[model samples]
Target: MLQHLLRLSYPTPADHLDPEDHFSTALGTIFSDDLANQHGDRDALITYLPSTYPAYPAVELRLADPAGEDERRKFAHYLWNAGVLMAELWWLGREEEHKWRVKGHAVLELGAGVGLAGIMSVLAGAEEVVISDYPAPEILQNLRSNVERNVPSQLRPKVRVEGHTWGDVTSPFPAANAGKFSRILAADCLWMPHEHANLARSMRHFLSPDEDARVLVIAGFHTGRARMAAFFDVVGDEGLEVEEMFEMDAEGKRREWRSERDGGAEDHGERKKWLVLARLKRKTSINSGSA
Candidate 1:
């Protein structure tokens, strides 16, 4: 892990994907500017063990639908701050003001670490929700544990834990599932530039072809703003473009998305506090410069 002074108010989980030779059992504690915005939980101290994850979503916000995690031996490697933030977006928005809607929609969570956002979808009234990650027995097992523990028995039938490799065809998710999800959630999954093409392809594969179908994307700038930019470009190549996008600071202030930004790759302190969120849709003839 990157060695830095972790002056944590509350833990924001870190999305560490790279396999490491020497790994520590340290559960990263992060600042919760997001928690403060959604609820008054900024000062809550986080306590996480090797087996469990951090940032209790219930400490501050109340669920729209009361919903209700287990991995004992293995450390959760993919749970990150963006996943929590995504969950917050779905769960925290006031009923009258929520633009990020999941209720009564088919939802998919890509690279769903700990399946936080997907669980929130279940709680928020998604008609059906699929929480998927890389096809690993332990990871899928952990995801199942989280979903079963959180979602109510009545709502349990609405959620499915599936092991999925992105950009795959007709293996994990059946052919019937193509273009099935109206809302696809991707948080902190764009850290790898090399996988950008595959990620874009998968988004194109699963996203609904309808005008209302949308993909929700969020990623931290800790993985360089350039990588995030490259992801947009690749998605465009796959016929998906951002209908709306913006940069948000750790303080919850939002800004316009720009191609250029200072200190995104250099200034460590400022960049770590920055992330981008976007809504994507399939390109149409109207958006393809029909004149």
Candidate 2:
């Protein structure tokens, strides 16, 4: 197990120390072993055990062949968004303020791909989780296979898989589901500036009416800052407000992207990868009585 951990580029310091040093060390060992011998002909199984929720079983997923031409170009199997999603889940488990967002709430994940975020939500005790992606037959099949393989039989009833295209507010998700989801998730779906409007429209249509309802969005810097900024602009124009945002590097170092207090200077270029996470809520309007 330790050898597999080394091969996977895990932090070296974690290996030498005892599990008592940190909970994640023990969890990482378990996952390293599970994934060591799982890579097969067309798929690979990756495992994750969030340190915050030790009681919950490690999340195991069988990823489709990324070498497929359509799969590679469509960005369906990349690991960037999944990494950020896992970190956010760990953070939520420890933070009292945001922990309740998943438990007993109606959750929706857009561009679900292999359904990592949505699957994690179910493990976190979400009342219901809806996973959606493009209507391509191969994509939907791969996604359904993943949910069936990972989610336990008992919990499978709480999950729903569907085909959805961004910007189309009518199909797949019916009128009855509108304003029903308390938490919506979008990961690594902001690379295309052209699709920003459609993404926002879907969020606006489905997000719950409660003021506290939120949409959790994350994306990597691989697409560049300009595209990310454009996505923010479109969402705002579509009536969503950013409540919090931050950037995290490969080492788990986080810096406030838009906060009252400045996050100290650091060289972002040195990091091979960086992710930005944001929480958004519907923009509220107030009507004033005539004076």
Candidate 3:
């Protein structure tokens, strides 16, 4: 029994196939010092290890998701292989305005698929971070466990995680979150056109109206420019102003591309635009008296 308890093991990269093979292969292609060569100083943006497995397999089943531990384990490997979470970590670590260095700012993260961006923000020094997504039982269960697993010992005590469903307008913000967040963040969340209205409304309801507040949206422009333009257009009419927008290339360098809404287009449409950072500002209340 003692020996069994002491046994430790983790699967190798070649051991499993993700549901999306291409994404998994692409992730394997980008490992290790490759990131340093790819992004230069920005290499510090993500933390990647040769093998995510423990040095020796020790029994720490507590880290496993009780509800869907198997499913969560598979998804974790897939996410690692595709470098999906790494992408968010890389983008959020930058010290620029779009980055998570907004310390002392209370933040809410929507559509926190796997909770990467929110966790990264806490690492990047926000005062408080809340990670939220739809309340589907399985997803929420895995989300809670993942947050518990990844919350750094140094930072765990500072971060919080909870369930939020964008589709439910009547569902109140978690009491701990009500009117408290000064910044809202979303990454790679606009790809689902079906969720656009709900995502936009959720943003409007929670984003702080204080002039100094900011809502940053970071997404990979894999779906083409037209759809991206339309999403922002719908949100614009609701008073979320796009303060600044910039495109980032595969290597994570800023590049020049005409925003479709701005009547601009990239001269060469070959390279993939891996990221877009949009800072959203809420409209000031005209109905309120000035200080």
Question: By TM-score, who's the top model here?
Answer: 2
Provide TM-scores for the models: 0.72, 0.75, 0.66
Q: Candidate 1 lDDT, tens digit per residue, 1-291?
A: 111201223334434322231122222324422222111122222221211125333312111111112222122343455766676672224672345788899999988756778887887789999988776666677678677667779999999988777777567474658778889999888877877887877887888776688899988876577877788888878778888898876545777887567744457556666678888988774343211
The collision pairs in model 3 are 8-57, 9-57
Total clashing pairs for each candidate: 3, 0, 2
Candidate 3, residues 1-291, lDDT tens digits: the string is: 001111122233533544454343344246432221111010011233212234312112111222455434322211211123222333434465344345677878876655655665675677888877665565556556666666667877777667786745465554334446677887666756666777776776676656667777776555556565566776765556677777665445666544563354633233233456677766554211211
Q: Using TM-score as the measure, name the better of candidate 1 and candidate 2.
A: 2
Task: Name the regions of candidate 3 deviating beyond 4 angstroms.
Answer: 1-23, 26-100, 174-178, 256-271, 285-291
Per-residue lDDT value at 179 in model 1: 77
Residue 234 accuracy (lDDT) in model 3: 68
lDDT of 2 by residue, 1-291 (tens): 111212122333545645554443344466542222111112334565554446766666554455467556666653444333443455543564463368888999898766777887887789999988877777777778878877889999999888788888777464557778889988788878888999998887788877678888877665556666678878877778788787865445677674212232333343225667788888765111100
Ordered list by lDDT, greatest first: 2, 1, 3
Clashing pairs in 2: none
**CA lDDT, candidate 3, residue 150:** 61
lDDT of each: 0.64, 0.66, 0.52
Best by lDDT: 2
Worst 10 residues of 2 by lDDT: 1-10
